[model samples]
Target: MANFHVYAAGTGSDVQHPTIRRIGVSDVLDALRLGFEDFWDKPSHYVFLGLIYPIVGVVLITWTSGGNALQLIYPLMTGFALLGPIAAIGLYEISRRRELNLDTSWWHALEVRNSPAMPAIVVVGIMLMALFVVWIVTAHTLYARVYDDAVPLSIGAFVSDVLTTQRGWTLIILGNLIGLLFALIALSTTVVAFPLLLDRDIGAYAAIETSARAIMANPVPMLFWGLIVAVALLIGSLPLLVGLAIVLPVLGHATWHLYRKVIEPAPAPVPVKAARSRKRSN
Candidate 1:
């Protein structure tokens, strides 16, 4: 993350006031580098949990196979990445512990289970799940709407239709537009909220508000960061999702660093002389 002081202005007299900051593209890249460093430092902590992603991927692929099922397959597999932020709760903890020079073992990493933020995190998790559910429903509706007369039951038939037909082209354009809407909402609300929840005792709504403010303050860099996340997760899912063992942890850790960059820490109180003069100074 960039120097905290640059963005650490006090929003109010309250100590816990969230201070949003603007960041550049370089800070985003730096966050990733730090994320990789954290991952390598404690590779063992993530290995077992990372293994689970592949198993989940395999299960999802198998469950969504066949002809008509093809349409759902792409969204279901990629859209699950929408939940990657919440799922990486453990990773954020690991990164936090590492940054503080605290214990970063399996026990400390999963400490989110007992965190004060658990209740709020649960609410946020449900919100993310809702977004994912909506995407799935929308995708299914789009597929059915596109192929009104008949259904394609095989992969080849499905592929041929989408590639060679005007209806397929329309579905592609419209489905992606709808999918993009869901993705942007997911990205804006949770990009920094999960990490903020893990770090503070604040409620979910507060964390989400702070995350939104952070993005709005740095719209350009946040947009670039969002694209990086979407592309990385998509690529990671391509190779039977075996790449997620490395990809998910890295992104999770990087998100913590990025959050640090965008959400300024509360500034120290003004000196006695300045405090008196600023009472009505807005």
Candidate 2:
């Protein structure tokens, strides 16, 4: 375990963050397992995932409606993932509630509203949204450069073009490379920050620093963890995004557990003894 710093609430003092337990690959899996348990045990709390499905439904409708925007759909689909940390705030609260054996409610997922961390959380959300917007713009620019002004008329045409042409292949390859960079930046900054902010009464800077430190300290396992998240999200986005109803909640809950594994709470301050007075002889 390593010591880190966090602000002591009300006392206005900084203290060592205790419980910075060493994490490993097993911990990631264990967190996922626990997350699964949370979702499976109290499935109703995750219904918001279902509520989110309608948004995907609209995207699906748009896709099939025109079938011409295939080039843009990939970016849109993947970009949907960029906002996941903020979107899953409810699930984090749910897991927190379950951890304390409090009554977890679908409505209570919005407990984030009452939290002192709301401002910081809002800032994180804004940061993610900005990245998402940038990614969309960059992706469109790349696609435009590759295709010139011609747009695909259907899904079949887009796939055929993307698969058989040099421009298509290059765009796919380059687009993903750029997206990878964006994903890494997002992951390193946030993998633990969101949970940390929610779990503690600290500023966003400390939360972000803790998250980055965790990544730097455990690169290998963290890389694997990132891979797991990317793959899980990609798979979840399939099937009309309905799979997300299950995948998102599990990952959301798992993230809280992972944060617990990666970062420890600050140790309690040791009280100092007052010096003995010379009045003993008197």
Candidate 3:
């Protein structure tokens, strides 16, 4: 058997040690389906937390409509982006702990806010914001170049025009292609890396490398998992943003399960003297 140990943090003497266990593709799919069922069964919990989606959406729409909205919305956006992952960490922990028949709470999950994993959360938030900025800037630049108008084209117009143009088609295809690549990277690592950091007290780099190695070692299963996530996200985007609430939470929960499956901590080493002594005694 391939044995490994993962050093986890905040695990009190009373808590069990975190270990990496072998997992399979069927396990990943089951976890995803279970997470969705859990969400559906307890819609109230998500509904309360998910209100932020629509509220943020409204604020963003208002901001786009030419209000001095940044004053109010920018901070909200940043906070939402930063805190969203932190919040998801708790859900992840809860799901795992629940599976183990351990006690867990929203408060416990919230503790991830102060954990070392925060850096990874913050980095992801920054990347998301950067992507949003790039998309906005590209749309505006294209509009300016195409229409020869100084005023920024509305997001709706930009999207519509791009969808209709050859350039737009190219951009769309290219964007999906790039997205697929990143999704593979993300699928391989993000699930295991973030929670592993929280549980292991390890740095993000080590967690990421460990995750990558796990992916490399199990390419077929990881590829299948990545494709599943990509397809789900694509479907989610079809309904505009509403699909995000369900898709995002389900993905978040499913990802926690995937992490559990892919990462197997190295096993503790047996002492050579103990082995020789045992053989002699036998």
Best by lDDT: 1
Off by over 4 Å in 1: 1-17, 66-68, 266-282
Q: Write the per-residue lDDT of candidate 1 for residues 145-173, one digit (tens) a residue.
A: 78873655787888888988999899888
Ranking by TM-score: 1, 2, 3
lDDT of 3 by residue, 31-93 (tens): 798778656745656555555564565557576558532222322332233233434666676
State the C-alpha lDDT per candidate: 0.81, 0.79, 0.57
- Which ten residues in a row are the worst by lDDT in model 1? 1-10
TM-score: model 2 vs. ground truth: 0.85
| Candidate 2 local lDDT, 50-114, one digit each (tens) | 45743764565587448665677888878768888887888898899899999887788877888
Candidate order by lDDT, decreasing, is: 1, 2, 3
